[model samples]
Target: MKKLTKFKRIVTRIIVLTLVLSCAGGVMPSTFTPNAAELYSDKEKYISYNEETEMYEYSFYDAYVYDIDATPGQIMLDIIPSTGSNYYNYYYHKKILITWHSYNGENAAQYDYENQKLAESIQPESRINIKFAAKNKYDDLSYKDGYLGWESHKDFYVSQIISIRNSDEHIYGDINDDGIIDSFDVVTYQKYITDNLQYKLDETQFLNADIDLDTEITNEDCRQVIDFTLGSSKGFNGATNIGSIRIDNTVSQAMSLGVKNDIDFATAEIKFGVDVLKKCYDPEKNNTENILISPLSISSALAMTANGADGDTYEEMEKTLGNGLTLEQINEYMAYFISHLPDKDKEKVYLADSVWFKNDPTLKIYYEFLEKNRKFYNAEIYKSQFDETIIKDVNNWVNKNTKGKIPRLIDSFNIRSNTAMMLLNTLYFESEWQEPYIDTIDGTFTDLNGQKHLIKEMHSEEYQYFDLGNADAFKKPYLNGDYSFVGILPHEDVTFNEYVANLDGKELADGLREYADPETIRLCVMIPKFKYNYQKSLKDILTKIGMEKAFDPDNADFSNINDLSVEGALPLYIDDVLHKTKIEVTEKGTKASAATAVIMGMGAAPPEEKKTIVINLDRPFIYMIVDKNNVPLFIGAATQLSEN
Candidate 1:
């Protein structure tokens, strides 16, 4: 019995030594055999020892444990070296190299400068165990803990057993590591998935290409990369929390104030729209012409210009634009309205603002004015030579913002020598109908002048109908029910001019506020397909609406825009207010673009239906595009249907 005990003890010692050597990363002897008790009993199991490779294979872990033949000095250098070509310095301080050595179950000690020297002195043939941990300084690096070796370390002798991989964290879709997520990354990712690149991605690039992080690169991953390149609000990982607009805490706090006062601003805007429409429309002279205007566009441009007005000039603009609301309230509300506007695939509304001033030493624009516009309206400010080139630049900007609808906003004739600065605003809208027209028929549209012309009329059944005593109205919704197109046809006895002339802002606002239940009201609606362009100079209209002093060259005070205290300084005043608009109404949807320029010299829906009503717009009528809040975006009088 004593002899048997000694033999078992010897076998146990051998097994323990083998385990220690394997764990320490030392080569296992081929002649050695593991005890039956220590070896896996089921040889068919996925996890088992391979005698040929002298390693343990774990199919479930998807990893392998192998012995590495290297000295303590070489292993240490592989992890973190004292000098040249060290893994620690290769990351260029972007990553913190953490390393330690363990033997006989000793606790880990930081592999600092002193330990590095001690490790370097060890002989090459001596076996040593080393492990590495790396922390990213920027917290942007992606890390995986395993035995997978980086391509850069493939040639190293320690790579077979090393667990350290040094890869810089890359922008999610920037596969090429060029520090930009763009179209090139999309192309490279496509080539990689199709094996068309004639090369394979490195470890880092391969990880980045997996934008969805699904461990498999498919067409979906490629599509996500494309979406990110195309300015999607979502990130590469398809996280929807990302926002296109960065609203700082200050802006966020102000947004609450704006929301509280939205109704007051809406009332003022409606009043302003009605007043501008009445002044611009001449029933006798423009009886045969259609008139369209974007109240939102004009108000935005004037609001931006209002920032540069001081004294009485500012008061008049504040009263006219805001109906008594202070500039602070106006700025905050405008910001709130813009940021809350819906922008999606089917429905898109974009508003862009820009300010340009003559580049002359004599004229000095206040930084505060420019900053205020930037903070509130996000207006782009520029200093130009006021030459022909500026005209092209301004026109190109307008064209781009308007989606090429209004190709030119200014000409050489508009930019005079005395023009100190110009404030411009552009609004673009494109949306599909909630219920598209199914059929079209030939019809005749009679102008107010009694002239008749053939027109194509889109026919659809609408559920929401309104009776305003003086006119019959219908509201057709756009996609998502966020906005609608409203039409009002006056009674046959009431002339179109008389109906408009008597329209009051409060009455119009109150009339629109009345919502029709789809279950109770229904209508067979017919609207003519029309496309036209309209332009007007608002110098006279604004003067008639209580801004006469703004146009006076001597009385105008735009001291906020420029320093009037300097000697021989050209006093700034409102030079001209130009408004241009274009609209196209088709069976599918509506496309409208408007631009308003305050050229300053120095200073600046619903559902259900039971009842039905037939409403045909074969004569002159009034139309408007309004939001869910009943706030008007555009209002027009379609007196004629001729294409412009």
Candidate 2:
């Protein structure tokens, strides 16, 4: 009897030991009670890749426990992988690092709402299960291992099979992840920085919250968010400020008729540029002692304004602006043009457009017009009281957009009482020459009036695009090959004004098409270093070019600008077409800024030898800053040189 009793005791002891071993192996019985203290580990584990399965494996060292009676809550996690891991390079993958927070029976609605907001915020990386479960609920709402369907359930294992890689794509100020950076994002970012955010974020959200990408959250990120949201600055991302604005400027996806081809559009731009230069060069019209005008800025501003015109006004404006292409075609061309403009290290080009209207209750703006401008032009629309402060506001915007090149655009009284709206475009460019000038040497430059001015000449001998057909033209590219400065030195016997008057768009286009090939052509170039600023009211220029009806208040039909049926609505016509431009050319390269405002009032190095072409700009000559597409950015005649 004693031996049998001892054997029974040993069997019981073995059964108890088996249960303990099973618990130690990560298999807890359903009835086992969990200790909250032992559920969490102090050290976090990173995800590791398994070569055998070719999958990323994440092993939970400890189970995070949320008691049945505990309040529903969230915990922001940072599960950064080890350094030099292959996963860090997967930037394009849509990924989210998700850990279940909690869902209580009493607050199921709250759980659904908060989780829904979180799911919406995950973008460019994660996607919510759009598939429906047995009921109307989304498959992802409920707990499911490996497959996050939106149905609700009661299991507390934090179940979901997420195959998402870590999200590495983060817009500079896109903290909320709604595909845009705006005031709401600024608020959320500020809260996160200040430690006042109500709920915690997941690992991906934390990654994106690092706005400056310094790997640490700070106050500067919040300030950057505010600056971008308020339009006080271009954007937080250093890649391209224009792209950041594009994120917010998302209107309709309908593609407009773009230019028929790059060459055709470039030819048209060349023609229009020549026309503008001719009109601006007329002795009776131009008042600037030294001239520099941005054909791109003027053309873009006019194109945007033409969208709001109709009848004779529209027809004349369209004829003047569009070189035979329809408005749809022009819209397509401008959209393509702006998108292709280069903005990067050492060579930066920023072009911004905006429309500001008086906050008059009687006016109603057309949605289609606004949408088209927003989508194509990426123009900012603002409605403000046309008070004395409007001038400061507009100038502030100009200063910010141009990086303070043209600080004060207008005085306090630039906006007349009859002015109903104002449209503006600002262009900023800075680039380093691929082959910088050797050095500044004192030289003599003869002005158009036969006046000889002592100037510093920049000399360099290198392989450049050179042709002596219509005129002696040599192209000097900037740091990148995206843009070039083409200087045309007319024949020694020909006068600057005479050559310009005779040079038409086709001739210039033909010469450029032939010479500006990617192949290197040997050339010796010598040009004077010049700095000049030009400002003018283009009213006469536009009228001279066949857009006269747009300036005439009585004859103009700008009925499309705003709803004409609204009470107190007055006829809207362009008040003034003002243009301000500044450029500096030195041994390094060029830094230029131009602002065009339309106010409406109720109303290098080397290879020489094979075929050497010499270009010496000792006399007056014409020059242009052009892009890869031969689209002229700035066109001017260096008739005079001012001593810096």
Predicted structure with the largest lDDT when compared to the true one: 1
All candidates' TM-scores? 0.59, 0.59
Model 2 TM-score (2 dp): 0.59
Off by more than 4 A, model 2: 1-261, 284-288, 464-470, 516-522, 603-611
Q: What is the lDDT of residue 525 in candidate 2?
A: 86
For residues 1-644, could you state the per-residue lDDT of candidate 2 as single tens digits? 89996776566445444443544554543332222224333221223344543334343211111111221333222221222211111111112222233323444455445544543333321212221111112222222122232212222222123323223235566675445665455556555655666666544456566654334667667666655554456855333222111122434545344443477677777888888888778654322266778878988888888888888888887777777877777778888777766777569999999888777787787777777777678888777777876776777788778876676577766777777788889999999888664336678887767778888778886555656565788788898788889888988776666777787876787788765443445577887887777888888888888888788877777777788777777778877899988887866578899999987766300003256567888877889999887888898888777543
- C-alpha lDDT of residue 596 in model 1: 91
- The RMSD of every model to the true structure, in order and in angstroms, is 24.4, 22.0
Tell me the deviation in Å of residue 631 in model 1.
2.0
